[model samples]
Target: MKAEKWVFGFIFVFFLVVTPIYWFMSGEIAGTFVLGFSALLGGMIATYLGLTARSFDPRPEDRDAEVVEAAGPVGFFAPQSMWPFWCAITVALIFLGPALHQAWITLVGVGFGIWALSGWVLQFYRGDYKH
Candidate 1:
């Protein structure tokens, strides 16, 4: 995490320095926007790492340990289902709607997408997998 923080911090600083230099050299608004946005992204990553570091101790990966111990079982993982396939079909419809200029199809796609996502999220809350 500390290494991640430093890497992002370096990127942030690099962008900060390059943005002005790029603007002065090219005088292009688009270049400045790109550089500024990149800097903002770097800052966001660094900030997230710093906040996360505060919440938990360093992990074996973070410490560069020669031999890391197992962290133990993670949690229950949901079994595979068909929701993703449905979601993909919905996405295809949504993209196709815009290409064919049909608003109704796009609306239907969005509705179905939401339903599929909801079903996937609650799949384990009932039936055989219910805890």
Candidate 2:
């Protein structure tokens, strides 16, 4: 935590120094605006850290909280999925077909591609019976 504070402080100060140098060298309004906004952000962040550091508390109950058993098993075992391979083929077809100017073929491939992709991805989230 102390290291994190020092790192943030170093970054804040480094940015403060770099921004002004960049602004002066470039003589651009955008650079100045960026510098100003960065300084404001740094100040706000420093203020937040200062306040949080001064007000932190350790709770005994939180330190030694009780663990509760879950009502049931966490997840179901999903069946093997082959649709991912099919979706990959369809996606390849969609790209190749369109590049070859086969509009109808591309459209059909894209539709099936989306369907196969969703079915493949969502199979894991289904109930045991569905899987």
Scored by lDDT, the top model is 1
Each model's lDDT comes to: 0.90, 0.72
Report lDDT (Cα) of residue 31, candidate 2: 74
Off by over 4 Å in 1: 64-70
Reference-based lDDT, residue 73, model 2: 63
What lDDT score is found at residue 76 in candidate 2? 63
Model 1 clash pairs are: none
State, as a TM-score between 0 and 1, how close model 2 is to the true structure: 0.39
State every prediction's TM-score relative to the real structure: 0.78, 0.39
Residue 130 deviation, candidate 2, in Å? 20
> In candidate 2, what are the lDDT values of residues 1-131, reduced to their tens digit?
33445556766787788887887799898877787777767766776766676576523232453445323466765557787689888988889886999898898998988899888877766666453
